[model samples]
Target: MTATATEPSRGLAARDDRVATRPLAARLLSRPEVGSLIAAIVIFLLFMAAAEPFRNVANVGTILYGASTIGIMAVPVALLMIGGEFDLSAGVAVTTSGLSASLLAWNFGLNVWVGILLALAVSVAIGAFNGWLLLKTGLPSFLVTLGTFFILQGVNLGVTRLLTGNVASADISDMDGFASAQNIFGSEVTLGPVTLKITVLYWVLLTVIAAYVLLRTRVGNWVFAVGGDAAAARAVGVPVRATKIGLFMAVGFCAWLSGMHLLFQFNTVQSGEGVGKEFIFIIAAVIGGCLLTGGYGSVVGASLGALIFGMTQLGINYAGWNPDWFRTFLGVMLLLATLVNMYVKRRADLR
Candidate 1:
């Protein structure tokens, strides 16, 4: 009787262990990150089925081309949001950096490397300012970054105009660093009849690196801690301030990279470049499963979100629809995704 009972107990424990493990696996698969990826795939399929041009190699390249810079920024932005902060000036800062690069190269006749370094330095400074204001004033990041956003916006346009006397832009192609920037951001590869911009490959590589760093590194652990609870993270010996500031700087650096691409790919730096993209980055981050309050997000999820944006941007055009309606479509999609994410998050928290 005792042996039979013990055998049954052991079987029950084994079953229970399996059951417990299953939920964890399921939970991992069902994370908000996974959801964003599903959304991207679903959107891509929907477009491919409805829009003939959507599946073409050319269109795919464009989708990725558009996604690259945004995707790059989205990773770190998601990190920042997960860390319970915001950087509203991020998009405008791209314009600032690009213009700075252009002016340094074209106007001042500086070496391209110097111009690039200057842009990066300025970006880091802007990021440091944002972090400082947030940490010192105890003001909400929304207000702080909003102020910075407007300031950068004005600076981007105002300074560019004052320097060039034109509303459009300055040409940086003749500059010394042009070759290197073009090599990195403007590289192209011939694939069949279509040319694939190699920056798309760069975006993919960056995404993989970002994902690995986010999911596999100790810094990633600290990122979660800071985002989950700043005070708690600090109490537990995490360098909350440094982590937050570093993330902001990363966002700035991404902005610089985007700026570099814009300067090379387009060969012009308009004062209006990257205007009104801050919220879009935030939207992508959120749609990728980032919490509005921070503490949870995924780089892959954010990249997928950027992919959705790119697909939608091109898909609507391929569907024989007015491209002007793209903003409306994006807004609606964002609203729905945010609602779904919020609902799912609340449900998970309850459980």
Candidate 2:
């Protein structure tokens, strides 16, 4: 063969070889997310088999109701984690935001919409303060957020006790726009034999939007950059500080949403509400594919993680098992997921 002809033939063979190897490489590098998803499905099926009551439509609705709050909170928490920071106060923030809105509307007779705005504003302030503290002190996020968590926890309890003299929640039914808010947050619309709560449907919608924002947008790229290496990101003009601060605000805002829904749904609150939820939110994010070290995660994966929790919570009860085991189950799941995440991260780092 002529040299030129031989070169072209060799090039084609090399191209074919590259194509064949690409998919294999991708499969190997793929994290445990796919496996986790499959495991989630298996868990679901197991619940279905052993828990006959779980198969009922009403029970399904209950799970959805439970999952909604957790899933909603998980979205922004996952985003924040992917951006490389954690918000330890996010759990208590829920109570703060909820109480803010409820008290404003019920005590001062502020319009529901106005009260909501104020509550969100409070959340933003707290979130921004968290970011500012982290940036200024060069402290680890864990310590920063732990401080915020304690402060907020105190504020939630102290303020509520001083004002209401009871752990029961403030009611805003008399506030304007209360009906509309209820329709959005509290109303349930049925589909055939399946009853659906608006919160669950809202969760599904938010998950879709959050997933798109993370996986298919420039902001998503920024999230990874900021989380992976803030110094490098800032050096490259990626607005690392702004991104991290903004993510904290987003987490706060989500807490507000969850709190608002809770206020409307239950029409009551306890000072202790949401005190232990921060870890749960993080767990859901990690289980979904978020890395503790940041720069890697999927929103859909986080949502799935919430579903797993929701399933386990209800499924166990339906299965007639001791509810006390949930704590143990959560501990096991967290350990397993963390180990898997660490393994995947180590392999990627080596490459």
Candidate 3:
């Protein structure tokens, strides 16, 4: 009896040891962000070695600033994509928000804060309308949001021209609350010899919050389930409509934040400023390991993808290459990322 008991204990210990000694490569490969992390490191090292200006601290700050601007929106876009929906209107919606804030304050003579609040409300409403239309009509989100994109685009250009007799809004830097708003959204913080935009902090904070919501909360489970199979999720009592609507609103909220940043940073917005940016957001999401089919993605991955974008945008300039080549680089990155993501997914499934 004693011998048998000792043998079982030994087996248990051996199993525990095997578990403890599992290969680190396996763990790393299991992460959705692992591919993005690798890509970021490779690109960083490449740019560091090849582009002299890329090594400068100030230039690094600029890269981070650019990344933050895109990352801030990318995170929410990733989440919405994971929830199995698209927002084609996201880019124009951002322009709409900024223009709303500027025109509301400048044209209506309201306080800047009021304009900000109203713009946020309008943005959220647009998002809600998109979500509602998708559910009510059982139509594809792509079509719904595409319609919204054009409508918002037309409104932006038409209203701006109608009001200002130009395609840009009047300057709002001198408005009441402009100083405070700028400090919150568009100000800079000095670290050592580098001045970084506040948007970096916002980007990081938003990523943390989104990651937590995705990984540690019930709603996160719902998000994944809904994205994976909306019908099954609904059958299991998940509030599919609410979850999707909430996701869209989250995107809207981020857009409002980004819009505020743009307005405060420049004090003006061209009606066409954000056109075609929706594709960039989608590409970033794809590069970050979010599947086009949804149900799998990480906010951290999306952020890293944005970082890669920022690096490439500046790195090429630092390398003294033609600016037009940027699109070619983006296409290549997108294709490679998609293939890697597919391979990773297949491996995970096999495991």
Ranking by lDDT: 3, 2, 1
- What is the Cα-based lDDT of residue 47 in candidate 3? 91
lDDT tens per residue, model 2, 1-351: 599899998888887744555555555556536535865898899999999998887677888777777999998999999998999999999988888888877778778878888998999999999999999999989999999999999888888888898775676676698888878768898877678788898789888988788779888889999999989988988988888898999888888888888878877667788888999999998887888889987788788888899999999999999999998988888888777777766665644
Task: Put down candidate 1 lDDT per residue, 76-179, tens digits, no spaces.
Answer: 78888988898888888888888888787777778888888898999988898898889999899899999999999888788778888986567777777688
Q: Which candidate is the best by lDDT?
A: 3
Best by TM-score: 3
Clashing pairs in 1: 82-295, 83-227, 112-177
* TM-score versus the correct structure, for each prediction: 0.91, 0.92, 0.94
- Lowest summed lDDT across 10 adjacent residues in model 2 is found at 27-36
**Model 2 C-alpha lDDT versus the unseen true structure:** 0.84
